[model samples]
Target: MDDLEKAETVLQALKTAEQQPPQAALPILNGLAGLVQGDPDAPLEVQEVRADVFMAICELGKALHRGQPAEALWAPALTAAKRWRGLLG
Candidate 1:
């Protein structure tokens, strides 16, 4: 598939993975990182959104893995996902 198509596929995977319990977020975040890294042809907004999503995912994963409350990470993830949706639109 083309880069854009691949990126969209990754993003959809992220979205689906985010809906699951915190235990499932890390692998999906790693997948997103692989999809976006070094892909300079992607739109600036898309790249930014993906980066935000990646960081948010990392934070959530860290929090969950460290035994912190999921709610502490949930807001940022939701915000990042909303921003990603806006960028996609």
Candidate 2:
């Protein structure tokens, strides 16, 4: 898919992540990362938010593996995801 489509998919995945278990959300985030693959052509704001989203995903994964509560990650993850969605407009 194209970058915009990929971004939309990432947004959807992020939304889904909010409701899903950590086990399920991890793969969803991974899939969104793979879908976009860090589109170099995107604007600086989009790139920044994308980086934040990816970082949040990585942190979420690490937390899950470390037995930390997933709740702690959702706020930042959702914030970044919302920023990303706003950038798309």
Instruction: Report the number of the highest-lDDT candidate.
Output: 2
The local lDDT score (0 to 100) that residue 2 gets in candidate 1 is 57
Every model's TM-score: 0.60, 0.78
Q: Write the per-residue lDDT of candidate 2 for residues 1-89, one digit (tens) a residue.
A: 66667667777777887697777776776676675466798888888888888888788777866768878787897787777767776
lDDT of 1 by residue, 1-89 (tens): 55555556655776676687767765665666665453567688777877876787777667767767766666676576666656655
Off by over 4 Å in 1: 1-38
- State the C-alpha lDDT per candidate: 0.66, 0.75
What TM-score does structure 1 among the candidates reach? 0.60
Candidate 1 residue 79 C-alpha distance from true site, Å: 1.6
Q: What TM-score does model 2 achieve against the real structure?
A: 0.78
Clashing pairs in 2: none
